[model samples]
Target: MWVNCRRYAVQAHNIGCYKTQQRPWVRQLEATYDVIVKECGLFVDQKRPFLGATPDGLVGDDTLVEMKCPYAARDLTPLEGVRKKKKIL
Candidate 1:
């Protein structure tokens, strides 16, 4: 048995794609909710110390924002991509 231990880097173009969409996504959500979205840092799970995540934005006290702006799904809305069976997740 062989395991591939290759490491891959995110391309600059891909990062640009996500950055391009992030602001609009955040703005729309903010306007809809009528609340300010704040930047956050790493949050570790209390039950599992090994588990942690850096969410894209935070809303209020309980809502954690997680944005997925896949470059391939750039043209389609998230719901439309889901309906079309695009691997946006």
Candidate 2:
């Protein structure tokens, strides 16, 4: 399983490291949409403290964004497989 794979762990960590490096470019792209993005922290549900989400960026009051900075073409392969599987089912 990916959760138990060392490569998965390293890739997950790399995404965090690269996210910071890619922020400037991401912000520039977002500006084209006229959306002012802001940093967000972990949001814990009041009734369910154990359930939380830390979105990449918040756009205005109603939108939450998640960003991905894939390092290689194969970085997106897993998602492609999921999409294909969903279509088959």
Model 1, residue 30: distance off in Å is: 0.5
Cα lDDT tens digits, model 2, 9-76, are: 34443656454645764576477678877877668779986666667678889998765554443334
Worst 10 residues of 2 by lDDT: 1-10
Output the number of the lDDT-best candidate: 1
Cα lDDT of all candidates, in order? 0.69, 0.58
Instruction: Please report the TM-score between candidate 2 and the true structure.
Output: 0.55
Query: What TM-score, to 2 decimals, does candidate 1 have?
Result: 0.60
lDDT digits (tens) for residues 1-89 of candidate 1? 00121124243425666667677878877886797889876677799966766677898899888877666787887578879898443
- What's every prediction's RMSD, in angstroms? 7.7, 9.1
